[model samples]
Target chain A: MSGTRGERFHVGTRKGIFTVAKVGGAWQVVEAGHVGDNVPIVMHDPRDDTLYAALDHGHFGGKLHRRPAGGGDWEEIGVPTYPDLPEGVEEDTDASGRVIPWTLKLVWSLVPGLDDQPGRLWCGTLPGGLFRSDDRGDTWELVRGLWDHPDRKEWMGGGADWPGVHSIAVHPTDGDRLTVGVSCGGIWVTEDGGASWACRADGMRAEFMPPDRAGDPRIQDPHCLVQCVGAPDRFWVQHHNAIYRSVDDCASWQEVEGEPTHFGFAVSVHPEDPETAWFVPAIKDEHRVPQDAHLVVSRTRDGGETFDVLRNGLPQEHAYDLVLRHAMDLHGDGRCLAFGSTTGNVFVSEDQGDSWTCVSTHLPPVYCVRWEGRASAG
Target chain B: MPRVAFTPNLQRHVACPPRDVEGATVREALDAVFAGNPKARGYVLEDDGALRKHMNVFVDGRPVRDRVTLGDAVSPGGEIYVMQALSGG
Candidate 1:
């Protein structure tokens, strides 16, 4: 193996499952599912060290299954549904009076329960809204306030899908306090679990729209927002125009100075340190151009106050690129990180994003990356 | 009239072979270049057949957002290169 060795690793695409390989401290896996095309989301459970995958289950439907640490049984978790369908919306009506089935797949924003809430799963769906399970993946319930907010419809942008919640962050210490980012909706926070919620939209602005037009009214156009526990009150937002840092839990923010003033998505933070973070920058505001520049990875050692380009071992130019958020991630150990790109390539860095090596060359546009540490060989 | 060249990255996926397109409209010139190749659609158009967001068609190194009637008139010998915008962390 030329890349890093993996004790345990998993790769998820729209298709199905892939058992990733550990080579030279890098993770790479052959596109394991039937080819053609499909969307897949992959996540790892820290509680039992299990990996759960939500296959393409596109639009309104799909399946949820779990794979063990070493890779064996992929047990089905449960049937996914629109747990919090807005009240007045009629269930599918028919001559049989049976609610017309609306198939939906769980585009989950996963979080493992803390304290005694083991195996607890928190997920958001495509039609938009949140779900929580306390029974170790056996059952689920919708977190009420979040789904029924007075601005729900407005927050969802009147699109066929509600604001798809993709990123969920639960404070490792405070299970009750949490924050989540809706794909098209700005950002929302819950101070006491899901009992009560508030839009943390101070310095945050809508990405798809303009400034004077930014606010809850335009909540449906948020770009991507993520919080770094390393800086409890701080958040990094890759809005439509520039990258912003909010120091007051998103209540307020100041754009971080950088090269990405026009476009990019997928922002991540070092698991242990707040000062360090990574994001994939893309070219083309609206269409895919063959002339994309280098796939650059920017680093901020002082908590996103400033950023420096990391190019030591990366392709200097003609990278043929695009790096997505789920495409890039920091492992349990902050020093090691991995990222996939639209160019069908994967890169790994043992000394952070400072240096890189191509692990795999031709995997379908890698949408997400998930890893598990291989138990150290005695 | 001006001309632009495709980078190596673009060359890998496209068979355009780096050449000048002759037409009065951006769409016409692109149609001529992509004549034999049909796989470059999604990379250029959205699911609805509209130009994808964040995409640009440059004439002589300058960026152009318009896809319907690219403002940069394709003079007899002008060249255009399609590019995906680069922005992000």
Candidate 2:
């Protein structure tokens, strides 16, 4: 499952976006764009072959930029704006007790629409706003159903003053069915486009809350959510407290038992096989380093029935890096998997999870990694 | 007309050459500049139209008085410098 020479991966980093391509049996840094800006997500829209980079300028707020398929200058597409608050709804309160208005702080996730709707794009933002664009990236409208949900008031922040929507999984077969994972807000599914959304965090626990409220749905925290393309109903979630697999279109979830550590950030599902998945386990939330200071990727081929740790070419000692939720990705039949860490390490595995190679290490802290390749070739 | 210039550090990210725009107040001068380069507005101001926490604007080498409304008065031929605040480590 070696990658084709010239296959490219767009990596979002703390400093900018770096283009890494496989060239002559080695991965090379082809280009470094958006220098000095914090890039959180880099997505390749298969419908039109457009590359989108979600830039989080610490001072100016977050913005989205797109470049053509082959190569071209990046164009700034406007970031989504949350609509005015409904009457009588109080603004979010910051740690200092100051009232903070709903603002677009960062673009955490970008998901392209189904094949039937090629021009459509879905974006999830900080402060828990879901936006959709029908004209590619021209104009955006906030999905009011999720923004105005009554449970939103209880959805507090995890690392910031407000909760953020970081993972979005659009059903491969049904465009109308989508699932979004929010930090400290649990899992939400929408079956009627943007008209309605319901919580689907059953069986998920939130240990950060009080003992009596640990199992409450409104307090569940999911770090990442990925769906199997071959089986749209099958979904995998790497939660802050544990890992879960949902087989019924995310209507219900059950824990994926017997993992080295239940705490992790990223999750990748096999493109063709719903039974295969990968996760990078850490010590825990407070101590977010590799377990025992040894980095390893855990894989389950039997749909969470059994687990095996892969550390052939990875660091086995004193590696204190944490992979972000969107920093790991699997492309083209799930055989080519790439993941980046907060310490600016990029690792790739062409033979699924058997072996690994460090692609780049001198770049800025990696935020997200995405692969762009043809499905049939792999 | 007041001449507006951006710090070199800010210009490295976004091209903002010195330009003269007709305006009576700091807000009007910034609005004139935003008319030509809308992207720069986000770098300097927040969604609520307040100057960003990490940004500062000076009129004729003096800090602007009004940050929320940006209502500082500007004289003809005055210089406005928009630069990143030197506060964070």
Candidate 3:
């Protein structure tokens, strides 16, 4: 009864379907429909057999769904809605005396659970901060302190419509310890499973500052996050203006040393090693240079401290084309990574971003990539 | 062969070097170039096989609505153009 086939990988495109392609091969339609926006996909542990797709509705609202690694139907996990509010109170308050935001927004990283709870799921959202579900897609509860802290409002950027949590990083061994990246607010950490929260942006640059204050300016936009899965203390972040890292668990951060490209959106960490990470860098000032001259993917082995351009089989003397952040990722094996450019070309690398080959063309501005494994192998 | 030059309206964002398609009518020319790039077909034609509401296919500067107008009589060297109709914010 073993149907395990060749090494396979799946990528979700905004075209509303998950395209599965053989490793270093062509893409074929596997699953279609909104697999969720800004969705994060994770393969089941130990075997990487089963896969879970956490559809982050993000600004538009999101849901979680599960499917076999080999591909089949989607089983939607219930998105928590406002459980009826107290009759005498305001319309917004739930029965538990909590105010439900306009919509349930989710743009999160999927954190696998530990111990007896083999199916625990953790995710962060825009309107709902952070949430954890013990039973597979059964129910969910908000992680208490991440966004409910007294200073949460002060930390969230002035422009943020809601205090949103975009990235989630749980300690690989100690599931209770976790880190959350808030788009406009900054980064927050929880040692006792979100029972409390604290700002960890002390060394990170704050992209936005008071009009009168002068600063490095890059800190104003720490938009995306990549947690070193193998190195919990380190992190590689992609901000709107610059790249940064924290070697000591959000305690402090330093800029990725190099000639900066000035703009980028995504970050992909090496699957087996935490120190190696990759990012898409667009040339400085030239809004059209395809991310640093010729669609080059930057690699850093010693965390974000240093980086080098990974270009061997890539095009030379080409038009400036940049890759989007959420548009790229590293499959679990750590040897391959797939990225889609704003130009609608899907590029894959079998040698860990060292080189790439265009696998597909004419994809509608790819937004995210996830891995789905063997359907029955699970 | 009738040649058509596909120029993007939002030239600042779309950097596709002008595409030339040859055919007896608008449909034939577009079909050849878009077969491999199916994701681009939505922006060019509507569900009814009519030109998209926001796009204009010009027969040498004059807009043509009939997608099947093969007798519109395009000469061998005549230049046809496909331009995105611009709109306001």
Candidate 4:
């Protein structure tokens, strides 16, 4: 094995953002930022060594802040704004008969733009809108073309009371193309930049939907979506009811079954290996706890040909930790992985799920985690 | 002019000093204060120009009846208070 540049990862928690670093040859919580606040989303822009945290003020609404490179004060930046409804337009309703408000409910996903487009950022939010930032986080503009699509009316919320975009993957080389995974709305792909989008989530099943509409792609909820950087055409979606794979650039999807459970909200693919992926499993539907109270990570090294439930160093009895969609992350080379759960626990695996170690506990409920350093030698 | 004061809790995240702003209604008064302290606008209201769901506004000790437009009338020299609705941990 060769040297690895990755050292730290930021964690978004129910009440603060924490930075854990490799100290004395072991991972330790080294710094805390934005304490005493609800931080639901955190991202590390490796391009510039900056950190972005999204704070949710129960009474004040959502806010975004970016710490510029070199570790300076966090700067409050412009958040995504929803333009008012057009004249004579009626409010839209979701499947549960709730009217989708034209407001920023929460900043769900923050992703750095492609390498070619420096200083560019993409923000995915609830109420289903994608915003693009040109000059880093100084300002942002909602991608209006996709917001006005005719098919968006069919989208609805899955676990949330309203629909939201929780996963975003940019093509490594194509700056104009990307895909966003929306809960209960499936995956939407844009080829001409943000000018247009289409729901290419065919073959995903939604048993939660009415029997007649079980196969409707637009209403399927992809809990999380990830693409292999080494193989852009290879994608994985931890759908609401089962695991799904897309090998044709999301043109189609197929179910990939895992044992003990097929329900979960987080999925990570090996950055350089399309055939490798990992998922945190829970009992299906109403029972979201770990199967029989055993916390395990299911991994597939042969493109779902088989799955190994890795439980070493993980809680295996009466554990109820539930990982959120953005809580699990993998290093660029996929040799190092980390996941945090709502139970306020964080664990790391260095040998790619063969073993694990708990790094922190008794913090706040963890919402998201991202690697802040370069990928390890794989 | 009505005296507008924000919850001290809000002051922790934003500098919201009590002030006398000119307005005939709750909306006008808040709009007056937010005009100079623009950063405080989002802390009090949501994107639709309405009081946040968990926020409350009081005019001279009475709850502002309309949270949508904040249309409740305000006296020339009355006291206005913007507070977070009481919540439990």
Q: Per-candidate DockQ versus the true complex?
A: 0.03, 0.01, 0.01, 0.01
Q: What is the TM-score of chain B in candidate 2?
A: 0.95
Stretches of model 4 off by over 4 angstroms after superposition: A1-5, A94-97, A374-378, B1-89
Docking class of 2: incorrect
Record all residue pairs in model 4 with backbone atoms less than 3 Å apart, i.e. clashing: none
lDDT of 3 by residue, A171-252 (tens): 7678788777765556778888779877776555542232221132212346677776666787878764467787788787
- Per-prediction TM-score, chain A only? 0.83, 0.94, 0.79, 0.96
lDDT of 1: 0.59
| Candidates in order: C-alpha RMSD to true structure | 11.0, 15.4, 16.1, 14.6
Where is model 3 chain A poorest over a 10-residue stretch in terms of lDDT? A210-219
TM-score, chain B only, every model? Answer: 0.68, 0.95, 0.67, 0.95
True contacts kept of 2: 0.00
In the range A1-378, model 4's lDDT, one tens digit per residue, is 112645678899998998887889898888999999999899888777888999999799999999977789998988888888789878766432347898999899999987689999999998888999989878888898778887777676666656788888888889789899987687999998899899999999876543445588777889899998889999999987799998999999989987668989899998888999999999865557899899999999999879999999999888999998999998875778889999989998888989988998788999999888533233
Q: Which of 1 and 2 is the better model by DockQ?
A: 1
The sequence of per-residue lDDT tens digits that candidate 1 reaches over residues A1-378 is 112333445555544455565557555664364344344567777657777777654453566767675557678787456553357876633211223233453454565666457767787765456778877566777677886676554443212223467767776667778787775566778989898888765665543332233444325334566666555676777665467777677676676665543356667776556667676665544443223456677788886666777767667677766665466666666666677766667677778788887777767777776666411111
Off by more than 4 A, model 3: A1-6, A23-48, A54-61, A82-102, A155-163, A211-220, A258-262, A283-293, A313-322, A372-378, B1-89
iRMSD values, candidates in order: 16.5, 17.2, 21.6, 16.7
State the lDDT of candidate 1 residue by residue for B1-89, as single tens digits: 33434433354566546656566767666665556566765567676555554454665433444654454466677656665432111
